[model samples]
Target: MPQDFVKIAQRGELMPGKMKRVDLDGRRILLANVDGSYYATDDTCTHEESSLSKGFLKGDTVKCPLHGSRFNLRTGQVLDDPAEENLRTYPVRLDGDDILICLT
Candidate 1:
């Protein structure tokens, strides 16, 4: 079977209220740590093609730097206007010191 979960980050590498961008197998994924919980989503913004990892993470919401659009990190749902499409989310889990994200 193919690998289900891919390692995204290490513990302490990403703190609460922070987001990071990871590239794996030509895929760009946005990883966010909200209140000690992890969430993964597409790094590209739905509004503008700006990088969401460069955006701001407030609580469970992320604001795009290009158009200031906000999205829920947990569900990839847009919390603001200007973005009609929702982001694609991935399942995240912590395995020891490894922060894994399911791309499958």
Candidate 2:
């Protein structure tokens, strides 16, 4: 694993179609599992700064619970209204049973 990438969870810790929030280095990161594939993104919504993990996750789109803002977990693109800016995405790497997230 790279020095910038740190293990956030185990492979079995998160099930498919579920999401979790990881607080590391004072930053909140949203980790999602979709069909065994993992993706990481900023937990804060671009519109209202609400935690995205508290919202809804359907497919790869995560909807903000506060203002209905939706963002793509894969590419960090905004997909719905009420959000003009896109969320920041992180690279997720799987090493054995470890789920690692890139900080840079």
- Report every candidate's CA lDDT: 0.91, 0.92
Model 1, 1-104: lDDT tens digits are 76599888997898888889999878889999889999999999998889999988899999999999999998999989899899999998889999998898
Residue pair clashes in candidate 1: none
How well does candidate 2 score on lDDT at residue 54? 98
What does the lDDT come to for candidate 2? 0.92
Q: Candidate 2: where are CA atoms >4 Å away?
A: 1-3
Across 3-25, the per-residue lDDT of candidate 2 in tens digits comes to 58899999898999999999998
- Stretches off by above 4 angstroms in model 1 are 1-3
Q: How many clashes in each candidate? A: 0, 0
Candidate 2 TM-score, C-alpha based:
0.95
Best-performing candidate as measured by TM-score: 2
